[model samples]
Target: MESDKMIKPTVSYHLFLYREELARRNARQLRLSRTKIDITEELISRTVKNIKTCSMDDLKAVNRELVFKRKLRNRVSKLRKEAKLAKQ
Candidate 1:
């Protein structure tokens, strides 16, 4: 009878701790999910704002400028590499 009483309280204490841990984990997961949702919403809003601000032609012109700059940058780097090889 004494052992049974001790065992029952011990089991109950462990069960309580387990439940508390599970609740904490669940709360943390819920918080993280909420944060993810907020970030995604912000990104979508920013993308929509950008699309609204720029006309199609403006966007195309900007893209073309970026492509031309990239090509020029690549050419410069290639020239630098060739000069380095010639030195060696």
Candidate 2:
């Protein structure tokens, strides 16, 4: 009986935390959405096109952008999965 009582509170706490996390994620997703996904791809493509021509700073900047692009893609995919889970 004690275990059953503990389970309910734990489950409620889990859901509460999940909801709060999702809310923060959704907000970030909104900001990320401002830029089209393709923009990153295009930027990478352009960077590659100018690879031999780019200065060290340009290359470093592009590298940083590439890292951000991966992070953005991962976050978007995660948000999609969470949305699907919420539907169920």
lDDT (Cα atoms) of all candidates against the true structure = 0.52, 0.66
Candidate 1 per-residue C-alpha lDDT over 1-88 given as tens digits, one digit per residue, 9 for 90 to 100: 8886665334335455545656783543333333333343434444456876878875675566556555555665666677689799
lDDT of 2 by residue, 14-68 (tens): 4555456567835455344324344566577778998999999989888888888
TM-score of each: 0.38, 0.59
Top model by TM-score, which number? 2
Query: Candidate 1: minimum summed lDDT over ten consecutive residues — where?
Result: 28-37
Index of the highest-lDDT prediction? 2
Worst 10 residues of 2 by lDDT: 29-38
Q: Look at candidate 1 and tell me the lDDT of residue 72.
A: 50
Error of 1 at 76 (Å): 1.5
